[model samples]
Each structure stands twice: as structure tokens, then as C-alpha cells.
Target: MNTTQLERIHSGKGFIAALDQSGGSTPKALQQYGIQEDRYSNADQMFEMVHEMRTRIIKSPAFDSEYILGAILFENTMDRTIDGQFTADYLWDKKGIVPFLKVDQGLAELDNGVQLMKPIPGLDELLKRAVERHIFGTKMRSVIKEANPAGIRQVVEQQFELGKQIAAMGLVPIIEPEVDIYSADKAASEKLLKDELIRQLASLDQDVKIMLKLSIPTETNFYSDLMQDPHVIRVVALSGGYSQAEANEKLAQHQGLIASFSRALSQGLTFQQSEDEFNTMLAKSIHDIYEASIQ
Candidate 1:
């Protein structure tokens, strides 16, 4: 592990920019950027367009480490290049932001009121490649839709189990077990999920430390204890389905939790805007999120 990068992530006062929109969510992300589905003929073309979008954002002046501690990349993007350098290299070398990769294949079918990550057949190989490419860490996601103890337990267990594997490869794992914001038992689900996370975290070895990316809890400071846990490097909040305004408002209520937003981070950015207009908008977004993160 690079101690410098690890220290930046541990004590940085800014939020993480989630640029890792995978195959399953790429179309919607591109559409929001003003590229229509009709613009691409196939998956290859779709990825090309999305990569272009990501490159433009990264190249923008507003996207810097001063207000953005790190950025997550999709596997495809990690393998690609920007200005003759690998994407991850460009991010850290030129932009001064730590780079992380999204490692999960995608979600599995809903079971026991939760949706776990599908098997990652080539994960070890991928992690090796990530280490070679200067990636500092990785993120994987799962979802909880109810307050079922059995279901939430499975979710946390899977996350920690995979997290341990990731850490063994000398990379921090951002374990995201999101509680669906619209679930009827949203608060109950968060409570149950928090307990399960605490239990899983307690069982880890002293040398292991992981990050948590969770939905904005229904109750403010609901995960305060987790934020202060020794095994947790950091606790970040996902916007889930909330708008940027709503997500930031909720994020500011928690003193220690920072933002790791995807859609919310890219909100209001479009392909049609002039360079000046685009940079200005992105700067504002970064500023707002950074301020909320430090609160």
C-alpha cells in the first residue's frame, strides 16, 4: 500500500467523485449527459461514448484534488487512456486525485429481500491488474430492500468477506450495502443493517481497515458509531435516488460522513455546454459537495 495515498484518503477534507458507471447503468448516465441512446449502435460504441464523457469531466479544471480527494473508475475506463497515460495514472499523476476501481460484476437477483453481488470470476486477476495500474482501492455494491435480519446479515457478510479478499491484495475496499431509500421499512432496515455492519466489522483482524459507502440514513447521525469505529477508514454517503440538493442537505447533517456520489456528482453537466459553462457548473458542484463533506 502507498502510505501517502492512504493518508490522503484517511484525512482528506473533500468528497470522492464516483465516475464508475458500469455497463448496467452507462446508458442512463450518458443520457443525462445529453447523449441519446440512438447515438450509439452497439455496446462497444456505447462504452466509447461514455468514456469520452468521463474523459471530458476529468480534464476539466474544476476536477482537482483540492476539493475532490479521489475518483472511482469503471474497469473499462481503468484500461483506457487519457492524454497518453492510463486513466488511473492521469488521475493521480496529473490531477493529484487518488484512483479507485469498481470491481463488482453487477447485482444478482433479489433474494431474502436483498440483492447481493454476482460472482466475480476474474476478481483476483483484476485486483492484480489494478495494483499494477496504481489503483489505490476498489468499490463493490449490494442492496437491501427491507428490514429482514436474515437478508441484511447476508448482505454485510458478503461485503466483509469480499472486503477481506480485497484487503489481502493490498487495496482498501469500499463496501457499499445500500438500503433502498423508498423501502417501507427504510428506518428499520437502516437500524438492522447498522447492527449487522458493526458485528461484521468487529470480527475483522486488527490489521484490516475498510471503508463504508451507505445510503443517507433515515435518521441523522444514525451511523455515528460506525464512523468512529477503529476498523473503518471512512464512512461515505451515496446519493441513492436523491437529487444533488437533497443529497447534500442530508449529508450535511452528519458531521463525519462524506459524499461518494455518482449521479449527483454529474448532475447538471451535459455534452452540449461550452467548455467555460461546463467547468463553471462542475466547480459549483464540487464546492457544494466539499462544503457538505467538511460539516
Candidate 2:
């Protein structure tokens, strides 16, 4: 995949990871999120999904050409029953696009042995399958999470190694941190992650692309505030159903790398639901804060 185009689509327009309860293989379920119906159940769905995606590209009203539509294929999406839809090649076929497998997949790999972390049991075989058919641009990998504090240095380093192997095979890694710390001192929490991420990036071989996933700080700092430290590379936030205006305010403030999430469409006692004014309240405020960080 062209890192330039992938970077362009992700710079301001971001990706959303699915927290949906549906089993991952169901193409029809993917349809709810604007994915193609043929994208599930088997590999045969690629033709349909790619065709529809092109149509949407042609019909988009907003200047969305710079963005991409993502179907987050997390662990739930990895069921063999739905093998056709979630494989590495299905994603590689699309131009400048990313196939977002959930972060949990990588975390799970840290324990099973680092080799398990590659795209599939035999990613080479899969890519060989793609190459034989002249497939060249599909990038694959997962939204990432540092599962435990133990052995994290090894985990991060090895993951970088995994990314290198994948890149050799032609795929990009969407590095992310799971929102695991909630209710802690927000400032300290952010600092902990920010500091460590910088350290990890420093540990890497130069020229590797690392994307930092951060939540829209509703009760924290602004994007500019986070950018004060130069160690940061990319900033990602939620597009999870926030109002376009809410998302925009955040976007305007984002200064570096940026992406979106789907948390806004979710409902719970903690969700911010006041529509009183776009200037303040809940997801809007958080999104505004996050959008600014990504800029």
C-alpha cells in the first residue's frame, strides 16, 4: 500500500474500531457499518466489497476522498467461519486502505509466542496467494494494545520486529493502545502512556511508522497541550458517532497524525448526550479536545 495515501486518509479522517457484539464473519452484520454484504462468510466477498466501496467513493457528497471506510476486524472478526472476509489479501486489494483487525489480536499473540503475531498462521502463504494473482497493495495488521505491564518492553520491541517482517511482505501496522485505564488520575495516566510511547518509538529502527492511539480527553488536556512534547508522532481519536461539528472542532486542533473512533454511537450511563450546544458537553467536548491533539 502507498503509505502516503494511507497517511493522507488517516491524517485527519480517522478509523473506528467496532465494539459490536456480532460474530465477525457475518457479511450482513458488516453491512450495518457500511461494509459490503459480500465481505463476509468467505473470500469470495472481496469482489462485492471492493466494487461497492468504489461506488461510494464516486457518490460521496462530502469531500471524503481523502478518507477510507474501515471495517474493524478485531478478534471477534477472526472466526474461521468468516474466513473469507477477514483475511490479509482481502484488505491488500484495496488501494491505500487499511483493514483494521482489533487490538486484542496482537495482545493475544504476545503470549502465544511472537510468531503468532504475524497476519495469519502462514502469512507468507497468504501473500504468496495474493502475489500469484498480482495482488500488491493490501496492508494488514491489528489495532494494538500493550496487554500487561509485565514484559512490555519485550512485547513492544518484538511487535516492531513483527511489523518489519510484515512490511517486508508489504503491510502496515496500525499501532494503538487499548483504553484500559479509566478512573485513574487522568493527567498521570496520560503522562505514563505518552512517556512510554516516546521511549518505545526511540527504541525503534528509524523510518518505521508508528501511530499513537489516545482517547479524546473529555476531562484532560487539549491536542496542542499533548503536542507540547515532541516525542509524539501520530494522534488518534474517536469518531464513534460524535456530531460532525464536534468531530470538526477536534479536527481543527489536531496538529500531527490523526484518526477517528466510533464511541459516539455507543450508549451507556457514561456517554455524553446533551445537544444543548456544540461548544460544550460530552462527546462533543471530548472529540473537540482529541481532534485538536491529532492536528
Specify the highest-TM-score model's number.
Answer: 1
Candidate 2: lDDT of 77?
30
How does each model score on TM-score?
Answer: 0.98, 0.49
What RMSD, rounded to one decimal, does every model reach? 0.8, 9.4
Tens digit of lDDT per residue, candidate 2, span 1-295?
A: 5555355534435443333223233343335434555435554464344333322322223212233334343333332212244332344343333444443223244441222233346656654544343232222222223333333344455555555654466544544443333324444444444555556666656555544455554343444444433433345565424554665564455455344443332222121223232123333433444444345
Q: What is the Cα-based lDDT of residue 150 in candidate 1? A: 97
Clashing residue pairs in candidate 1 are none
Q: Write the per-residue lDDT of candidate 1 for residues 22-58, one digit (tens) a residue.
A: 8879999999999999999999999999999999999
Show where candidate 2 strays beyond 4 Å.
Answer: 1-63, 66-120, 126-155, 181-187, 217-233, 239-257, 262-295
Cα lDDT, model 1, residue 165: 100
Which regions of candidate 1 fall more than 4 Å away from where they truly are? none
Cα error of candidate 2 at position 229, Å:
10
Q: Rate the local accuracy (lDDT) of all candidates.
A: 0.94, 0.40
